[model samples]
Target chain A: MEPAEVEFLAEKEPVTVIPNFSLDKIYLIGGDLGPFNPGLPMEVPLWLAVNLKQRQKCRIVPPEWMDVEKLEEIREQERREDTFTPMPSPHYMELTKLLLNHASDNIPKADEIRTLVKDIWDTRLAKLRLSADRFVREQETYAKLDNLTLMEINTTAAFFTESLNHMYKLRTNLQPSEGAESQEY
Target chain B: MADELELFEQGSDAGSDEVLLTPAELIHQLEEAWLNEKFAPDLLESKSEIVECVIEQLSHMEENLQRAKKGDLKVSIHRMEIDRIRYVLSSYLRSRLLKIEKFFPHVVEKEKLRAKEDPSALSPEEFAFAKEYLENTEMFLKNVTLKHMPPNLQSIDLLKSVPQPNLDSFVFLRVKERQENILIEPETDEQREYTVDLEEGSQHLIRYKTIAPLVTSGAVQLI
Candidate 1:
């Protein structure tokens, strides 16, 4: 999957936004949103929050986990753990970029949070690479990937899968009678 | 089926106790289907019911919005929601088309092999598209190269020429329902095959062939 597609899916995650303009409860096909009273906070999807922020119609409340203190702790915990640590949000990486890029003013210590998130991302990626190398080197057919998020998986999906395919093809060629490729097709 | 997401409320068929799937839950299912089709190596069974329901929902929302004033904020929010849902709907259909174009022969063959009582893997329109694509491809091959070849070589097996989806490819997925003792086949002869139990909500990286049934049954989801 393309990184943009992962970001697209992330955009659907709900975020809290305080709309400046008052509006009645809007019934959307996916469900309902708003009943907007000016200055009161309500939950809206990230896509809408960004749209409203661009028009200066709302102040996005950076999600609870976007705080610098919380993220610093997360980064520390991530570095300490060999396996992936549970993320504050499933799309934490995408959410940070989206929120920080569009509405930095709403979030406190935006720069610090950005750096912290980048640190956590890099740390997790290194662990992912190490594990992937082990998986390949060991020629393991199955692996439990608990706590790995979609964006994390997508970063190496294409190259990793292609290499595995090539290795499998080469391995299978040695066992010519068991041509698994032609069996199903 | 509605229980698969675990985000829905509440009913089953015990004589007219119809499951009340909210519009939100229906959209969730459509999105799941979209992602599954996108990641899956092979074409999955067509979710025509979900496709039709989503289309109906979108049009119904649009119709309601038609009566509202242009500058109305509610109208704008509704429109934005409509656009978002429409994007998912189109992307879902487009991805299916891409797969069909890649494996037209296999897709059509699967459709034929399906039992009469079973649902088709392709929607009616997609079935037509695959059939036509196959014929056009053969005709093009014949016109361009096959005609000039020896008579004995003129007849070609499209199936042999086309590549099939690699079922052995590893995929990232999350379990929806807990399963016990799923056997994981070894990649090489020296390796011993073993079984692993799947716990609900945990993710895994495994060969597609090992969990193809889980994908179709909605027990596990491709990430």
Candidate 2:
């Protein structure tokens, strides 16, 4: 999957926005969205929030997990664990990038949050690579990857799966008779 | 009122499979189908009903928006939503077309072999497209390349020449339904096969062949 597509999914996530202008409730196909009152915080999708922010009509309230201290704790937990750690949000990385890139002024200490997210991402990716290597070395057919997020998986899914397919092809060729049917792609 | 709405929905293909999903649920299904089609190695069963409903919904909303005053915030937001849905819908259809082009012969063969009662893997339009594509490719080969070959080599078996989908290819999936005692096939001789219970909401890396049925059944989602 494209990184942009991952970001697209992240855009569906709801974020609180304080609209500066009041408006009536609008009926949308997916659902309805607020009868806005000035200064009242209302929940809208991240895409709408970003657009409203761009138009200077609202202020984006950063998601609670975007805090500097909480992320540091998650980063520590990630480094200390041998297995994948659960993320605050499944699209945490993509959400952080989107919010910071488009509405940085709305978020406090954007630089620190950005650096912290990168650290957690790097740590998770390194762990993912190590486990992938072990999985290949062991010739294992199944792996439980409960804590891994879509963006992290997408980064390695194509390359990892192709190499495994090649390895499977080579292994079956050596045996010749047993797995003959599956050998052909 | 609810009964009347349900009766109205029953007139369309959308009501045939399952209960009527709200417009929101229809959008969500389209996105899910988009991602599934994007990741799976082969063409999946067609979602033409959902596709049609979404298009209808979008056009209906679009016509309503047209009469509204310009520069309205609601109008713009609706337009953005429309564009987003259009993107996913087109991407889903485009990926199916790409797979159709790559494995046209096999796809056509499968369509032929399917029982009359089963839902077609290709929608009516797609089936026509595939047939036309197959015919055009064969004609191009015969006219441009095959005619020049020796008499015995004149014919080409597309089913043999074209590669089949690697059904055994590894795919990443998230289980939506808890399944007990699913067997795992070992990659090599040394490892013994074992069964694992797929707990709901857990993710796994496994062979596509093992979970293809699960994918079709909507018990697991290909990530």
Every model's TM-score: 0.92, 0.94
- Give stretches of model 2 more than 4 Å off: A174-185, B1-18
| Candidate 2 CAPRI grade | medium
Q: What is the lDDT of residue B133 in candidate 1?
A: 97
Residue by residue across A1-185, what tens digits does model 1's lDDT show? 89999998999999999989998777777777778889999999998899999999999999999988898899999998898989999999999999999999999999999999999999999999999999999999888888888999999988998899889889878454333334232
Clashing pairs in 1: none
- lDDT of all predictions, in order shown? 0.86, 0.88
| Residue-by-residue lDDT tens digits, candidate 2, B110-181 | 999998867688999999999999999999888988899999989977777777788889999999899998
Q: Tell me which residue pairs clash in candidate 2.
A: none
Off by over 4 Å in 1: A174-185, B1-19
TM-score of 2: 0.94
Best of the candidates, DockQ: 2
Give the interface-residue alpha carbon RMSD of model 2.
5.0
The per-model DockQ list reads 0.52, 0.53
Which candidate achieves the best TM-score against the true structure?
2
